[model samples]
Target: MSNNKIIDLGSSEDPLVLDCGKSIGPIKTAFTTYGELNETKSNAILVCHALTGDQYVASEHPITKKDGWWSLLIGPEKSIDTNKYFVICPNVIGGCMGSTGPNEINPKTGKEYGLDFPVVTIGDMVKAQKLLIDSFGIEKLFSVIGGSMGGMLVLEWLSKFPSYVFSAIPIATTTNHSAQNIALNELARQAIMADPEWKSGNYNIENTKPVKGLSVARMAAHISYLSEQSLHEKFGRNLQNKNKIEFSFDADFQVESYLRHQGFKFVDRFDANSYLYITRAMDYFDLKAENNGSLIEAFKNTNSHILCASFTSDWLYPTSENKVIIKAFNALGLNVSFVEIETDNGHDSFLLDEPEFFQTIKGFLDATYKKL
Candidate 1:
């Protein structure tokens, strides 16, 4: 296969075992792969995504009809540089894409699972993806990289299956969800579930869904991805649709208009119940549980080279949180490097078109590829 070609893995229809000894029934994971698998299938890179992201990493988005979300980093001669390595991006198990999510019909009832779907965690998602990797017959990965929730996935991969990857890059993520982060998530869920139109999360029928509630939730969640400076620079006190104020609940300021637009667009594509379930999964993730409940112990036997990045203005996860991860790597004296990017991009910085981030990614991949 040429580097430009992409292979598709449709689904996992069988009952899948969970690390917790529970079972996931009829699970289907949707994923896309770019580039060739190489003679030894050693050039594979797993592209884990943040919340609300999907497997369309470097392809066109079917829903938005726009380019893939991370096309900025995963293209010819780019950071991920599909020309050189096989890249795989999977729609997370809890996502609203082609993956089996809450919106998917429950074969048992012939209706959307909605709240009936089993709640999944970051570890569960990783285990599911591991099945996909094993199907390829590739025992080890060239690298695993992600941001925000994606970053958390990277951390979990290192801890859960340390010997399965060659290197890891986790950007702008936390060791565990903080009280403040959990509070924000709770508020967003409340907003979505609060709408009278929610109708108990079974919005798949009736040709209707909870727009106001979902939009409000997206609007609130979007704010956390940005910083005050970013908000000021992108949309400040500038008036919306008028030079003067017509204050009524109308989107008078540009910021309000942006947030409103963000909310409205999100509701069209995402499921309200999936939002609740995914966020809850993230909240329940605690990385230190396996290694006698100690974070440092998790890395003692790890050999995967790691690159950890944090942003200066990302108060959501914050630089301090990144330090906790670095400290763990230090205690084990693991092969890890830390870079706190000096930027005003906040948590979403890892998502945006940042040239410096691209460079760091390129450098990390190149150093690892040379070893291979």
Candidate 2:
């Protein structure tokens, strides 16, 4: 294995053939691994990341220097228990991390892929991950775990390569993008495209960034990740710095200030074009359509044990969405478990400090490991 964490696939005859019928070659997958793979490689777990997430799953984020996004739930003695399982999280192809995304140079044009990069689907993302797993010489993953967009990838994995996955945990995600979800994504995309600095996705050439547009997009999307109850508890009508509300458009409320901070900070670490591509991929995701308009048919090939979880307050991907999946599993008589955790943290409850959520995951993985 190379000392550098970034795994270089190098120019090869077997380039990544995408779902769009286009091929991208010499792909590089940047990832991080925790713990060690057992001799049989039966203890390896693949951890898929959500939107705006990188492969730095359990390490300090190189850019922000903050703890890893899932540091709370993954470590030596954490819920997932890194000490027992080898965990690998790779930055998806459309991501801005070290992955080969729109920000990277195209071998043919010698410039960034920009808008020329083919739109990728969740299936494409899982295909890229499958290559990474093959490179590791792992025949079958002990378990695949993820939430939100990550959860979508988990579903894609189970559908595309049923035999390669032993178990799966898809948290707070649906098999297909809902109409409301597509509308929200369109709003965010319009925000980015509206900025003149975007320059038709060639923002890098002019040395100008679509910061304002991207910031607004992030702010808008951030609201959907939190529940009304949690937002109220955190910053309900509270003044930012003054006792009285300012008449100007300046941020007067604490909530406004908080959102502005999140928006601006996000721009510093994320790419506008990459954001567009990833969200477009999500909007195009419809497993039912891919499987002859039958959502249950998509999982017909998978015998992998599955644990589907959702939060009561997660309106974006509510318990109802998970129930839909559980019903499908029941129809197939597959070994599946469903849990609706009571939380006020909304769709992001999986990422928050919910003891019950952690316990549920720990318990499931532990039981699954014993069987393995």
Candidate 3:
């Protein structure tokens, strides 16, 4: 296993037509890898990150110096077992990380693309990932794994290239965004656009920032990512800042203070326009289209064994949503398994510390390790 934390693949500036009919760019995707691939090159596992997640899945964040989002699962001898499997994590296209996104400088405009960047879909992202895999000279993947938007990409990969992948594990995710999910995203988008400093998504390169609206949007979406129980456990009626209320229009609760910090930190590390684009892509995702207008048809040709897991409390992509996918696979007679881990982490369970989740993944991958 390599102790090095980061690997740069440089840039890939391939132009592409997004699902929205605009010709956008597929920018250079930076990725990180761990573990040593076997001679057969069959132990490679692609770990996809969720929305707002970057390529720092199992490594320290370059800017924050914080532990990687999935460090719990992807360490040398952890559940992901980097000592046994080569793991690859890439920053998705349209992301704010080193990957090309709305924040990238548009050669034509000589400025940040911002809203000018063309809209992209989940399929477009998977396609770019395929290119990256090819660059590594790997003929097939041992498994494709992810959660949230990353799970959406896993589904896309299975639908688009059923012949090449061996296994998939989609956690706390859905095939398509429900009306309720769409509404939540729309509200967040509205919050961002409502900001006067947004300046119609073309804010100049000045120190001026769009704080209020972005904070509100982050606050709202953050709530959706967490369950009520989680919020209560973390901040139950705790006072903010001072021991008692200031009796003024300010943060008076611990939750408010926490949200404010989250919102503020998010903007510093993420581009607002990229958030709008990525969330929109997720909102428009519809897997049925790939399966002859039915999800079962999509999995019909896949030989991959699936392990679909969800959190009992993940309302964002609840157990019911995971059942829909399992049912679709069963209808096609594909080998599939499902597990609904009970946790209060909500949609964010996959990223947090969950021993049961980690053990499940370890056992599943170990079951197929010999096949690789």
Candidate 4:
């Protein structure tokens, strides 16, 4: 039996409207829950997954048979202790793991949506998540937490439906995608599109996939998620299974081999079209532009306690980016905390076994729960 739960949301009467001026209905969302909802139903927490993450937050991933992505920080006695709080994690609408996306059959034509899938925005994603939360009758979430792209969703939740969130932690994320960020995403998209097998996103119909293009895209994107220090420490200039470079386009260095492994491994689980769509969404994310050119105005509706954390070596979304968020909260005089965790693990530090990060979240959540 699959470990996750699947729910069909939206209907003919109430279709999910996309930012692109399109509508879809009866969208399927795969999710998983941990712990139990208390009698008051106030201890519920929403955990948004990152771009490549699914609903397997604290359980085994059915595909890879690997431990949940955020297992390090969630469990019976972990930071977001399930014993004390109920956790709800749902696959985003544009996800491939049993969610409505390009890989799924379109009800209108009964074939894969492919390029025909409606473009989704961060706001659209948060809107879909709200439906799932409402399904559980959760009036206000005890906390909504995530890192990286997941963090962007948290910000969207705070901005669009402030009253529904009690507290939030947006880690290793920015208010908007920087120019460099957009450039990197474009590079990945081009890589996928350049593959001959892509066939304008109709590879599925041909019983083929642009695995080479997708793998290269994943490799390039994965590098941005790490710091130079971490890379040097982990692989450096070491040769890959050889005493010296006998290489002529082969993976001569360990770093190249490592990245190749990561890239190829990722292709086995992720969908190429999904990657294209999600990256485009990230590139289009801009809180300032969305809220009349004012980041503070974007969050003015929120009264929730917020904590923003960043890694010192995370050039992808540096501490400065995170501070912009804190500055907005500060301008609004909202209860907020900022932590620049000292780590060289880069943007992926939040996903690693960083004790300081763990303790910080644990303390903040404990304090927030007490206030509840």
The most accurate candidate by lDDT is 4
**What is the per-residue lDDT of model 4 for residues 1-372, given as tens digits with 9 covering 90 to 100?**
346999988996799999999999988889999999999999999999988888999999887988999999999999999999999999988899988888999999999999999999888888899999999999999999999999999999999999999999999998899999999999999999999999999999988889999999999989999999999999889999999998499999999999999999998999999999888888889999988999989999999999999999999999999999999999999999989999989998988999999999999999999999
lDDT of 2 by residue, 1-372 (tens): 221177766365778888899888878788999989989999999999988888988888877878888989998999988899999999999888878889998888899899999888888889889989999999999999999999999999988899999999999998888898988888989999999999999999889999999999999899999999999999999999899987999999999999999999999889999899899888888888988988789989989999999999998888887788788888889899988898888998888889888998899999998887
For all candidates in order, the CA lDDT equals 0.84, 0.89, 0.83, 0.93
Superposed Cα deviation of residue 222, candidate 3 (Å):
1.0
Better of 3 and 4 by TM-score: 4
lDDT of 2 at 205: 82
TM-score for candidate 2: 0.98
Top candidate when judged by TM-score against the true structure = 4
The residue pairs found clashing in candidate 3 are 12-28
What is the TM-score ranking, best to worst?
Answer: 4, 2, 1, 3
Give TM-scores for every candidate, taking all chains together and pairing residue i with residue i: 0.94, 0.98, 0.93, 0.99
lDDT of 3 by residue, 62-174 (tens): 77777888999997989988888889898888887877678788867788888888788898888778877877787888989999999999988888888778989988889
Q: What is the lDDT for 332 in model 1? A: 89
- Model 2: residues with Cα > 4 Å off, grouped in runs: 1-4, 10-12
lDDT per residue for candidate 1 within 32-136, as digits (tens), equals 888788888889999998888888888887777778778899978888888899998887887888677788877678888888888888888898788779878
